[model samples]
Every structure is written in C-alpha cells, then in structure tokens.
Target: MIDSHAHIYLEHFEEDVEEVVERAIANGVEKILLPNIDSTSIEQMLRLEEQYPDVCYPMMGLHPCSVKEDFEKELQIVEDWFNKRSFLAVGEMGTDLYWDKTFWEQQKEAFHFQCELALKHDLPIVIHCRETIDETILLVEQYEGKGLKGVFHCFTGTVDQARQITNLGFFLGLGGVSTFKNGGMDKVIPHLERSKIMLETDSPYLTPAPHRGKRNEPSYISLVADKVAEFLNLSRKELDDLTTANTNKLFFPSK
Candidate 1:
C-alpha cells in the first residue's frame, strides 16, 4: 500500500527515522510520499528522499500556513527546486484559515502559482485545505480545462464537496481523521466512489485510532485502511489494491 502523504522527514522522527521506515514497510506500506512545507524543509525532505530513493518520494511546494508577506520569494524558491528536479507532485499546497489569517491573500496566490506549476510540469498536486475547502475548490475551478489533477490531501469535506473535487478529476485523500468516532468521515466515505479515494496517514500528525494520542507514523496506515475497508464493506486487501491503483493513476501515470 502507498502512504500518499507523510512528513517523516521532519525532526519529528529524528531519533529513529530508520525504525519508523522499517515499521512502515513491515506494516506493508510500499511507498511514503513526502510533501515540502517551505524552503526550510527542502533540505531534510530531499535528504530523506535521497536515502530512500523510490520508496520515499518527495513533492515540492510552499505549504499554505507557511505563506507569508514575502511569499513571492518563497515561491521563487519553490519554482527553482522544480527546475532542479522532478517531484511526485506540486504540493501540499492550498489555503488554511484554521491558523492565522494574516497571510490569507498570499496563501491563495501561492496556491494558484503552485497549481500553474503543476500544470506546467504535467504533475499532480497534493492539497492541504484547512477551513478553506470552498475557497480552495473555487480556485481549482478556475483551472478546469487546464489539465489540473491531484488529491485534496487530508480531505474532511462534505459529501457534496467530495463530489465537486472528484468531478474535477481530483481524488480525496482519507487519513486518520476518518477513523475518529466524531470525525464525520464515516458518514461520507461510504457515499463517495471508491475509485476517487486514496489513503494517507499525514503522519507525524493525525495518527489513526487505537493509537490516536501517539505521534503518527506510516505504519499506522494499516489501521486507517482497516477502518476504510470496514465502512466500505471491503477486505483490507481489496481496499489497498483499489486505493493503490487510484494513487498510481494520479502520481505515477507514466507507469
């Protein structure tokens, strides 16, 4: 199975990063995709990618929360990295109003710029929408015919909103939140098309239930999958195979 988004590269796992990767592989996670938070995170992200090669892929983008007054400069840094190497996607990029709203406009601008970058590179984007799903959808709508395709990573939207995203050729990335008792995803997952679904851990955050209070790791993806499979009335293998196919269709189309 593929962990479509994770940040194991961060200092969150500094002491035992190798053990975390081993545990993930042991738990049957075949790939772990890493998303860059900003210029500051690029070094560690690339370092981890280099160490793991194809097993741990890297994506380039400025995270929404990281968007600030000098976003243009940060964007330039992101674009420069794109020119330097190929990435699995151009994200985790999107607007986040959950945090400070000081950089709201800059967040939108950064999202648009990164979306254009994804289009230019013919790559998918892994979005990060927090309390700004509607706005993010509207912005993505502006690129309807421009070959935009990707996943709304860590999606926690309404069923209709899920439909809106998938209708535009994007996937909904389900994570640990889906397993929460009151996470509300249980009500929506069963209603959405399984083909448009992808499983992710968003690890080092959103750890699945039974392990909710602990620091999240890719190994817990199996728990998330198990919950999704249960709700969808599917076997774990069936769910994994389906979501892995969806992931490949989005991130590894050439293969």
Candidate 2:
C-alpha cells in the first residue's frame, strides 16, 4: 500500500518520526509521498526523504493556502528546487477557498503555473482542492489534452464531478474522509470505478473514523483501505491491490 500524501515532516511528528514510519511499514504502507507546503517546509521534507530514501518520496510545489502576496518569490524558490533535484510530482498545489480568499487570484495563478511545471517535468501532480472543486476542475479542463495528469488529493466531490475529473485523465485520491459517516464518499466511491481511484492518508489531518479527531499518521491508512473496501464490496486485499497498483503506476510507473 502507499500513503499517497502525508506531512510527516511537520513538527507534529518531531518526537517520534521513526516510530511513525515503522508503524506504516509494519501495516504494509510501502511508500509515503510528502508534499511541499512552502519555502519553510522544504528543508524538513527533504531531510525526511534523505533519511527514508525510497520509502518516502518528496514532491515540490507551493500549497494554495500558502500562496501569499509575494508568491512569485516562493515559486522561484520552488523552481530552484526542481533544478536541484527530481521530485515525484509538482504538487500539493491547487486552489483552496475554504481557508482564505485573500490570495485567491494568486492561488489560481500558482496552480496553473505548477500544472505547467508538471507537464514540463513530465511528472504527475498531486492536487489539493478545498471548497474550490468546480473552479479547480474548470482550470484543469483547459489543459486536458495538453498531457496533464494528476490526482485530486483528498477528493470529496459528487459522482458527476468524479467522472469529469477521471474523463480528463486524472485520478481521485481517497483517504480518511471516505470512512466518515457523513463524508459523502460512501455515496461517491461505489458509483465510481476503482481504476480511477487511489489511496492516501493526508495524514496529520483527516484521521479516519474510530480514530477521528486524533492526530493522523500513515500507519492508520489501513483503516482507510478497510473502509473503502467495505463500501466497494471488495475484500481489503483487493482494494489494497487495486489502489496500490494505481498509485505505483502514477508515481513509479517504470516499476
């Protein structure tokens, strides 16, 4: 299994990062993808990647919420990292109206810039759309046939929206939210084909039910897998195999 998105590099895991990775591996989470939030997060994120190497892959991008007045400077820093080394993708990037709209225009521009970066680098993007799904989808549609491919990380949209996204050659990333009683994913997941789906934790956030409200960790991705399998009427192993295959093909295609 792969925890397609996690911020284990944050201070939340400062005291026990080792144990968290151990628990994830023990629970069969073969990889954990770390998405860069901004300039400040890059060092710690890269440190964790250097420590875990193949087990933890790092992606480069400026998160929407982090898009500020001087976002161009931040983007320059992000581009510098790309020149420095290869990343699994160019994301954790997208628009987020849920938090603050002060940087809305900047966020949209940054999202478009990063999308172009992904295409330029020939890497899949890991998108974070919060309360701006339709707007994000609209922007993405403009680049449909331009070879844009990425995942809608932490997707919580309707079946129709799912179809729109997958039809654009994108994938929906399911995580702890799928296990929530009123999260609406129960109605969404079953109607969609598993091939267009992938598993993630978005850890240190969106912890699954039975463990909701607690600080999420990668080890708990199994609970997410179990819940998704239950909704899709498939065994846990089958769900794991299917989602794992989807993730591997997206992030590690040659493998």
Candidate 3:
C-alpha cells in the first residue's frame, strides 16, 4: 500500500517516528509520501526521507495556508529547492478558504506559479483544497492544455466535483474522512473509476475511525483501505494494487 500524502516528518511524530514507520511497514504500507508545508518543514521532511530512502519520499512546495503577503519570496524558495534537487511533485499546494482569507489572491497566484513549475518539470501535483474546491478546480482548468496532472489530496468532495477532476486526468485521494459515518465519501467513492483514485492517511491529522480521536499514523492505512474497499466492493489486496499502481504512476513516472 502507499500513503500518497502524509506529514509524519513533522514534530507530531518526532518522538517515535521510527516506530511509526515500523508499524506502517508491518501493516503493509510500503511507501509513505511526505509533503512539505513551507520553508521550515523542508529540512525535517528531507531528514525523514534520508533515514528511510526507500520507504519515505519527499515532495516540495509552499502550502496554501502558509501563503502570505510575501508569497513571492516563499515561492522563490520553493523554486530554488526545485532547482537544487528532484521532487515527486510540486505540491501540497492549492487554495484554502477554510482558514484566514487574508492572502486569498496570493494563494491563487502561488498555486498558478506551482502549476507552471509542474508543467515545466513534467511532474505531478498533490493538492490540498479545504473549502475552495471549485476555485482550485478553476485554477487548474487554466492549465488544461499545459499537461498539468496530480491528485486532489484529502478529497471529501461531491461526485460531480470528483468527475470534474478525473476528467482532467487528475486523481482523487481518499483519507480518514471517508470512514466517518457522515463523511459522505460513500457517495463519491463508489461512483468513481478505480484507476483515477488513491488512498492516503494524511497522518498526524485525519486519523481513521476506531482511532479517530487519536494521533493518526501510517499503520492505520488499512482501516482507510477497508472503508474504501467496502465502498468499491473489492478485497484489501485488490484495493492496494489499484491505488499503489496509481501512486507509482504519479510519483515514479519513469516506472
């Protein structure tokens, strides 16, 4: 199985991060893809990636919530990192109106800039759309002919929204929210195509049910897979193969 988006590298897991990886591997999570939050998170993310070169992978970008008045400077740092090394994608980037909307314009501008980077690097993007799904979709729509592709990470949107994203060649990432009785992903997952979906824990955050109130870790990916499989009516192994293939295609495109 693949954790398409996770931030276990953060301070939340600093105490027993090694054990966290061990538990995840023991539970069949073969890879954990780490997304950068901002300039401060890069080192921690890269450090974890180095420790588990094969198990943990790193992606570079400025998170939407982190966008501020001087977003241009933050973007410059993101672009500089891209020049310094390779990243699976140019994300954890997108618009978020759920929090402060003070830098709404800057968030959109930064998203566009990262989209341009994805087009230039021929890489995918891992998006974080909280309350701005349509707005984010519209921004991505502008790159329609530019070969932009990636996943709408932690997707808990409507079926229509899912169709819109998939139609554009992007993927939907399902997480713990789906397991919530009222999460409503039940309406979206079953109607979707298998190839255009992936599973994620969004760990240290959206911990799956039965463990909902506790700290989330990669080891619980199976709980998410179980819920997703129940929606698709597939076995655990079947779902794993499907999402893992999708993850590999995006992060390890050369394969």
Spell out the clash pairs found in candidate 2. Answer: none
lDDT of 3 by residue, 98-211 (tens): 989899988988998999898889999989999999988998899897789999999988889989999999999999998999899888889987899999999899999989
lDDT for each candidate structure: 0.92, 0.92, 0.92
93 Cα displacement, candidate 1 (Å): 0.5
lDDT tens digits, residue span 132-250, model 2: 99999999999978998999999999999999999998999999999999998988899986788998889899999999999999999999999899999999999999999999888
Of 1 and 3, the candidate ranking higher by lDDT: 1
Taking the tens digit of each residue's C-alpha lDDT, what string does model 1 give over 148-215? 99999998899999999999989999999999999998899999888899999998999999998999
Candidate 1: worst 10 consecutive residues by lDDT?
103-112
Number of backbone collisions per candidate: 0, 0, 0
RMSD of 1: 0.7
Off by over 4 Å in 2: none
Instruction: Please report the TM-score between candidate 1 and the true structure.
Output: 0.99
Model 2 lDDT, full chain set = 0.92
Q: After best superposition, candidate 2 residue 173: deviation in angstroms?
A: 0.5
Report the poorest 10 consecutive residues by lDDT, candidate 3.
246-255
Question: Candidate 1 at residue 5, lDDT?
Answer: 94
For each candidate in turn, give its C-alpha RMSD to the true structure in angstroms: 0.7, 0.7, 0.7
